[model samples]
Target: MARMIVAEMCPQCGSLDVRATEPGWFRIEWDRRDALDGGWVEHLEFGCRDCGMTWD
Candidate 1:
């Protein structure tokens, strides 16, 4: 079986605490940022909660 490349680790702390920065229950308005930006501007983002780093 061929292994697929999934993600690039966080550079700062080298922690795997990275995931899609989703809008939680309290902040439904956060979803609007996606539409305002564009098709994939803030919609698909990677965030590392470990060091609190978020990026597109």
Candidate 2:
């Protein structure tokens, strides 16, 4: 059997139909000369379409 991976889901409606507002991609800087050495991070403000629940 194949396993399914879900990235995000609505907590209120328990629905997979979710949208992100003001999504941003950021890199962690740790006082390093090379910024590439830091890891990449994602910031998302999710909102549920069904229940209109928003969260960071």
Candidate 3:
């Protein structure tokens, strides 16, 4: 199994005030064959209604 991580940031202004209008799940992949292959692989989806910005 792999662990996933997501961040809230504004793509336009690069602000941390980014909020999630829609919440969802993100799937991550891990490469057991490689030592440093296990990390953040995918992001679900999130949209900021404040600035009308969408990010993952």
User: Evaluated with lDDT, which candidate comes out highest?
Assistant: 2
The local distance difference test score of each candidate is: 0.66, 0.72, 0.57
User: At residue 40, what lDDT does model 3 achieve?
Assistant: 38
lDDT, model 2: 0.72
**Tens-digit lDDT track of model 1 for 1-56:** 99898875777788788887544323437668566545343345677879978776
Order the candidates by TM-score, highest first — what do you get? 2, 1, 3
Worst 10 residues of 3 by lDDT: 21-30
Q: What is the C-alpha RMSD of each candidate to the true structure, in Å?
A: 6.7, 6.7, 8.9
Estimate, for each residue in 1-56, the C-alpha lDDT of model 2 and write its tens digit. 99998678987889887887656544444665256534443466999888889998
Q: What TM-scores do the predictions have?
A: 0.45, 0.50, 0.34
Better of 1 and 2 by lDDT: 2
Clash count, one per candidate = 0, 0, 0
Q: On residues 1-56, what C-alpha lDDT tens digit does candidate 3 reach at each position?
A: 99988777777877676655324433334444244434433345666666777866
| Model 3 lDDT, residue 45, Cα | 63
Residue pairs that clash (backbone atoms under 3 angstroms), model 2: none
Q: What is the lDDT, from 0 to 100, of the residue 16 in candidate 1? A: 87
TM-score, structure 3 vs. true? 0.34
In model 3, where do residues sit more than 4 Å from their true spots?
1-7, 21-43
Over all chains combined, what TM-score does candidate 1 have?
0.45
